[model samples]
Structure formats: C-alpha cells, structure tokens
Target: MSERLKSFIRERATALGFEACRFASASAPWDAGERLAHFVGEGRHGDMGWMETTLERRAHPTAMWPEAKTAVVLGLNYGPEADPLPQMADRSAGYLSVYARGDDYHEVIKGRLKILAGQMAARTGQDVKVFVDTAPLMEKPLAQRAGLGWQGKHTNLLSRRHGNWLFLGSILTTAEIEPDAPEGEHCGSCTACLDACPTAAFPAPFQLDARRCLSYLTIEFAGPWPEEFRVATGSRIYGCDDCLAVCPWNKFASGAREARLHAREALNAPRLADLLALDDPAFRALFAKSPVKRIGRDRFVRNVLYAAGNSGDAGLVEPVGALLGDPDPVVRDAAAWALRRLEAAGLA
Candidate 1:
C-alpha cells in the first residue's frame, strides 16, 4: 500500500511539471542538525541571522512538525541554455545570476506544491504541509535522503540527471509512503567548484562561509561592503554563479524546460550604466516577479555601482556620480567609492 502511494505521488508530481520526485522518511534521525549548529556557531552564515534563530526547528522535519512521517521531495531544473561564466567577462555589463534572471522560483514552485499537497491528502487521507526555500525546514538534506541528489562540494545539491541546476521544493506529510534510497556523493577529487569561486567562500570541501559568498553579499548584506569584496564582486550585480557554472557535471545538463524559468532577454547582460540609474519605482518595475526585486532598489543599485566601478567604462562615470546625493546612505557611500575607483583607473 505504501509503495503504491509513493508511485501515485511521483506520477502526479511529474504531470504537474516536476522533473524529479522521490520520498523519504521524515522522522529518521540524521546529523544534518549538528552540522547546521556548527555552521551557525562558526558565524559562517554571515548576516542571515535566521539560521541561528531557526536552529532548533531546522534540526529535523519532526522538530518543526511532529506528525510528519514522510517527505515528498521535488526537483525542477533551471539549467541555462549555455554556460553563464563567460557572461561575466563583459565587465561593462551587469551579470545577474542565472537563477535570478528568471521568474522567482519561490512563487513558481509554491503554487504547484499546494496543488500536489492537496492531491496527496485526498489519496492518503493524511494532512500535508509544503515548503519552498523560505521556511526553516531543511529541504536540501531531505532531498538528498530522498535520492533527488546529493549535496556536492559547493554545498548545493548535484544530480547525475540535472547536474547543478535543480530548484528544490518539499511536501511534508503524515503519510508513511515508502522512501527511496539516498544518493551518494559523486564529486571525487575534483575541485572545479571550489577553485572557481572569486571570493573563496569555501573554507574546505563541502563547507561554505556565506560571509565571503557573493550571493550573500549582494542580496543579504545591507550596509556598505568591505573594500575587498567590492573589488572582488566584478560585474555581478545580483548573485554569483561561478561555483555552479564551472561544475563538470553540467556536461550532462540541458536548458530549462519551463519557459518561465528561462532568462529574460533584457536581464541577460544589462548595461551597468542603465542599472545604476534605477530609482525605487523603476527598479520595482524592471524586476517585477524577479528574485532580484527582493533586495530593493537601494541594495540593487549598490551592487550595480560596484560593478560600475570595476567596469572601467568611462561612460558610466556620470551615472555613478549622480548617485552621490541619493537618499540611502549605502548607495551614497557606494557611489563615493565607485567614483574613487573610476578616478584611480583614469576613467573619471
């Protein structure tokens, strides 16, 4: 009966557009919680204080909900048409991470998860709850246990079928569905992801220090960044893709099948000058439904200013300088630093 239920859920998930769907025992004991405690203890999470606050609840699925007996993990591939690393070489243009270049995955995945959860409840007569990336639930570890993929050296899920480009979502339920065998790590000796990091965010294999991660710096950190990170940021305005793009496993990957997950033409490689000119309303309009919009206009422009400073494009000086008197102190401070950088490059 449990095996039949699992098969039914998997088939329904595929019909609803999930590329991979598997089950795992939610109540099983694991060491993922201890590692998370150590990550928070070492202050590796950077400005994301939520990790510390939710530490206990994130220890396990049952920690958050005692009734959860099974986890139905789902994977949606968002692979780009081509490698995104080369786009960074065009320093005059801003590089939004491949994931952020499309519609926000949280909004895209959550709606489908609700639909699936409803169907699962009807079939099994069990209560269900869904989670995307927002909640305290540790979806990646659950996905690994469910055989969706194994967490790689870069600390993100990697799959033989989807490679480095799968977006994870989970449904925790009271149903005792049969669980799939867990996947083992396939990244032997290869350090492509670790070496590719511009900021050296990894302290060791399978460990990440979010403090130095460009994704955390651009999207999470609110204040002016230390000078070193600004210079290291290059033209990446929203998030960095160096670690994910260079993975050798991507050879097996293909472009995203979902049209909404495809990169918008305007966001592929936007001009730094044009991005530096965005006000609150303009930024919201330009980034509507984009994950980049969550950072707000000020932070987004601050990132663009760093990119502008690194660009060495003389045409951007006027736009960068105009932000000197902006209302946000962070934006103003970034403008001052960018102007100095431009002057140092003899471009001002």
Candidate 2:
C-alpha cells in the first residue's frame, strides 16, 4: 500500500511539471533539531526575523502542523538559458542573480504546490497544507532525507540530473506514503563552492553565514547595509550565485520550463545609471513580474547605487547624485555615499 501511494504521489508531481518528488516521514532525522537550534542560536540567519519567529516550528513538520504525516517534497528547476557568470565582469552593467531575474519563485512555486495538494485531496480525501520557502521547515535537510537529492557542499540540494538549480516545495499531508532511502553525500573532496563565494559566506564546507550572504543582506535585511560588506557586494544588486554557478553538476540540467524565468531584456544587464533614476512608481511598474520587486524601490536603488559607487564611471554621477533628496532615507543615504565615492575617485 505504501509503495502504491509513493508511486501515485510521484506521478502527480511529474504531471504537475515538478522535476522530482520524494517522501519524508514527519519525524525529524539525525540530530536535525539540535543542529538547527545551534544554527539559529548563532544568529546565522541574519536579520530575517521570520526565521526567528518560526524557530520551534521549523525543527519538525508535525510540530508546525499537527496533522502532517507525510511530506511530499517537490523540486523545480529555474536555471537560465545562458551562463550568468560572465556578466559579473561587466562593470558597466549591474548583475542581478539569475533567480531574481525571473518571475518571483515564491508565487510560482507556491501556486503549483497548492495545485498538487488540491489534486491529492480530491483523490485521497486527505487534508494537506502547501509550503514553499515561506515556512521554517528545514527544507534542504528534509529533501536529502526524502531522497529528493543530497545536500551538496554548498548546502543546497543536488541531483545528478538537475544540479543545484532546484526550488523546493512541500505538501504536508495527513496521508502516509512509503519513503525512499536518503541520498548520500556526493561532494567528495571538491571545494569549488567554497572557493567561489565573493564574501566567503561558506566559512566551512556546508554551513553558510547568512550575514555575509548577498541574498540575505540585499533582500532580507532592510536598513543600511553593514559597512564592511559594501565593497564586497560589488555590482551584485540582488542575490549572489557564484557558488551555485561554479558547481560542475549543473552541466546536466536544462533551462527553466517557465518562460517567465528568462531574464527580462532591460534587467539582464541594467546600467547602474538606469536603476538610480527609478522612483517608486517607475520601479514598481518595471519589476512587477520580477523577483527584484521584493526589495522595493528604495532598497533596490540603494543596492544599485552601491554598485554605482563601484562602477567608477563618471556617467553615473548625475543619475546617482539625483537620489540625494529622495523620499526614502535608505536610498538618499546610499546616493550620498555613492556620489562621494564617485567624486573621490575623480569619476565625477
């Protein structure tokens, strides 16, 4: 009966366009709770208050939702058609991470997870709750335990066929399914992921310092960016992906199935000068579909102006200088800083 249920769930996931699916029981695995507590205690999640709010709930699925018996994990690949690594060298244009270049994964992945859960409810009459990254569930570890993929050296799940470009979602159901054997670690002696981080976010092989992670700093944290990190941020206006991109495992995966994940023409290589001119309405209109919308106009512009300071281009002076009196203090402060950096370098 369990085997039949597992097969059925896998079929449902594939039909829903999910690249892969696996099952993990509600019980926490192999010191998962203690490790998680340690991670949080160290304040590694940075200023993502949501992580702190959801602490107790994240350690175990059953604790978060009383009825959760089976976790049906799903993976979606959102890698781009082109290699994003080369663009990092382009000082004239700002680089937004590949994940943020497309439609927001939160909306896209959540919709599909909900639809998959809806189908299961219709077929089995089981109560189910859908969760994407929004929940505090230890998603990566659960994925590894469920045999979706092993957590690679970079701490993201990896598959021989799909690489590290997967977005994970879960359907926690009251119904049970047979579980697959957990995947074994395949990283071996490779430290490619560790070597690639610009800010050295991965202090050890598998652990990450969220404070140094560009994704955490730019999107999750709101106030002025920490002073020490400004120079290391470079022109990465959004998340950083050097670690993921450098992984040799990605060669097997294809581009995203969703066309919206493709980089927009304007955003693929935006000039620093262009982003500084983006006021609230203008920014919203421009990024409605893209993931960069989460950071809002002020934070996004602040990030862009940080890049403008690094841009070392006199052409950015007038555009970036204009934000000094902007409505958002964050943007104004960042603008003042950029203008000074530009003038100091004699680019102004």
Q: Which prediction has the highest lDDT against the true structure?
A: 1
lDDT of 2 by residue, 74-186 (tens): 99888777668899787768898888887888888887888888888887788998888877777888888888788877777888778888889988889877667888888
- Give the residue spans of candidate 2 off by over 4 A: none
What does the lDDT read for residue 299 in candidate 2? 86
lDDT of candidate 2 at residue 5, scale 0 to 100: 70
Q: How many backbone clashes does candidate 1 have?
A: 0
Q: Which pairs clash inside model 1?
A: none
The list of candidate 1 runs beyond 4 A from truth reads: none
In candidate 1, how many Å is residue 148 off? 1.0
lDDT of each: 0.94, 0.83
**Pairs in clash, predicted candidate 2:** none
**Decoy 2 TM-score against native:** 0.95
Model 2, CA-based lDDT = 0.83
